[model samples]
Target: MALLREEDRQYLENLFKENLKDKVKIILFSDKAAGSKLVVPGRVECPYCQQTREILEELVSLSDKLELEIHDFLTDEIIAKKYNVDKIPAILFEKNNNVLGVRYFGIPSGYEFSSLIEDILDISRGETQLSPTTKAFLATVNKPVHIQVFVTPTCPYCPRAVRLAHQFAMENPLITADMIEAIEFPHLAEKYNVTGVPKTIINEKVEIEGAVPENIFLEYFKSALKD
Candidate 1:
């Protein structure tokens, strides 16, 4: 049986056909020690697993822009440790030896799937779709900015915030964007007091809750830099 329903497969196919203009290198890390079992309870099955390989195989074959590289987390401890990967099915996108983006825990399914596609597109373009004002403000930023957006798989608004943070990180390497699944990493959620979806923590000091406009996000981000 296919992991994705027939309609879902066609939907994904149409998505790749319409988008995917630049090269997308997707590094998939699989934990052999936890093979076929989810590291986080209730997480989706690993695409490389026997039951789901066909689904991934079909998806990969449909897109020339996407390059999939698989690594066994247990065996390739060095690479896994380098990326600080402690979970299965992690994704890291890089270019010219710099980390472009990351999906730290599980598959970006459901509504988050569109955000995943936008991430790839933004990374491929090597630029962000930030407004001119936001771009100008971000250009003046000299210090490092680390943005972590905690989310759940079911949140509809989480992706907008995640994509904005990702775009900022992609445009400015001094910035790092992390999309943390709230339920998957309970400790993190508790630490940051993530009571709601789309919570953003900047530089461990400034916390912005909810999906604000890009300019508003930049204002909060800039304010954090001054502290």
Candidate 2:
């Protein structure tokens, strides 16, 4: 069965027709096996790897400018290391033949799908929807900032946090943002202590529990830089 609805596919086709100005490469790392090498020794599972590949294939079909490259996390260790991908079902976006720091650590389905679309648009345009103030603040960031927003496919507010961090990454090359599906990465969830949805951890230091306003999020981001 197709994961994307017919209506949704049509909508994305139109959206891509109007918005995409440049090529966007979707680099995916996953294990084809039912049990992935990245998982625990006794844990025989790769819950979303197969489904995630299907969704990505459908997505690339929607636009000529969009492309998909699939790789095995275990066997393609060198490529995975180049992208700093250590998890199965991970995705990285590339534009102008330059890979960006934006990524998704699981299947970007449901509400999070919109976030993926917007990210492609932003990368193609080489800009973001952030206000001048936010952009200005991001420009001042000299050091690297890693923003990881934990989410679930069903969460309504998760997209906001994901998009915000991704936009920050779009504005500044020093910032790398990720949308991590908490359910798909249980170990990471426990490591980060993510109990609720839209939990954003900036630089693994500053943490926000819910979707927050841009201004408040900036405050947390700045705090992360201090640590």
Candidate 3:
């Protein structure tokens, strides 16, 4: 069974066909034993890695401009450290071989699927749909800003928050945005105290509890930059 329905696949095919202007490389880190029940000693299990790669494989199949690269997180410690990926089922995108700061820390299924596609389109077009004001602000960011938006697959409001953070990353190289599936990484979620959906943490300092308007989010983002 495919993760994406046939009808939805057709829609995305058309979408990517019409919009993609540059090639987008999708990078994934996973283990092969994820889909199996076999136990591997001394290695922590990654439950969703296999399914995540499968969905990405299906996704790249929909568009000629999209590519997928899979890596074993256990054996590829150097590569994982290079990308700062500490978790399994991690995903990131690149264009013209330039890796973006945007990342997905779990399966980009459910509502977040749309966010994934939007990021690809934005990367392919070398542009974002953020307000001009927001883009201008992002360009002036000098310090490293890390934005982590905690979300669940079922949350309807999470995509907006995730998309906004990702677009911010695209606008500025110093900014890194991550979409963390709260249910999958309970330890990090607990550390951050993610009690609700659409919780966004910026610079691991500023926290936004809900999905705020674009301008409102900008205000919070600025606060994160303040000393």
Candidate 4:
């Protein structure tokens, strides 16, 4: 059975045709290719890796402008390190060979699917929906800003936080935004004390609970820099 319904596939095809501009490359660092027989040291069992690859494969087939590249996180250690990817089922968006800081560290299903789609569109257009004021502020970011939005697939408000972080990443290469599925990565969720959905951890210091407006998110982003 197809993960995406036929109706959803058709909708995405039409949507990509209308909105996608430049070519967008979808890169995934996963152990899916290794299958169950192979075992690499330090690499744990990835229950969602295969499903994640299947979804991404199905997604890229919708548009000619979209490309998919799958790399084994263990075998392709050098490549993973280059992209700062240390986890399985990690997704990255690339345009013109430039992999911006927009990354997804889990299976983007349920409501998180919208965040993945919008981020791809944003990368294709090489622009973001953030306000001019936000853009101006992003331009001044000389330091690195890591925004990790911990989410669950069922969270209705998670996409808002994820998309905003992704758009901020698109605005500035120094800002790396990641959407982490809390259920899939329970250890991380516990590490960050993610009790609620749409909890955003910036630079491992600033934490924002719930989905807030763009201005409020930016304010939190600014505070993260001060730390």
- Which candidate's TM-score is highest? 3
Give each model's whole-structure lDDT: 0.73, 0.88, 0.92, 0.92
Candidate 2 residue pairs that clash: none
lDDT of 3 by residue, 66-119 (tens): 999988888888999999999988999888878899999998989998899899
Tens-place lDDT per residue, model 1, 1-227, is: 55677897787778777766667777767744344444665443444333223334555666787777778766788988987777666667866556664554555666666777777767666677888887777777777788889887799999999898988877676777788877767778999999999899999999999999888888888888985
Prediction 3 TM-score vs. true: 0.97
lDDT accuracy of residue 212 in candidate 1: 91
Q: Candidate 2 local accuracy as lDDT?
A: 0.88
After superposition, candidate 1 runs with Cα above 4 Å error: 33-58
**Residue 92 C-alpha lDDT in model 1:** 73
For candidate 4, which ten residues in a row score worst on lDDT?
32-41
The prediction achieving the highest lDDT against the true structure is: 3
Positional deviation of 69 in candidate 2, in angstroms? 1.0
Please provide, for model 2 over 1-227, each residue's C-alpha lDDT reduced to its tens digit, 9 standing for 90 to 100.
Answer: 78888998999999989988988899998876744455555332568888889888999999999999988787788998988897778989888777888999988988998898889888877778888898988888899899999999999999999999999988877889999999988999999999999999998778999999999998898889995
Q: List the residue pairs that clash in candidate 4.
A: none
Ranking by TM-score: 3, 4, 2, 1
TM-score of 1: 0.82
Candidate 4 per-residue lDDT, tens place, 87-155, comes to 778999889889999999989999999889988888998888899999999999999999999999999
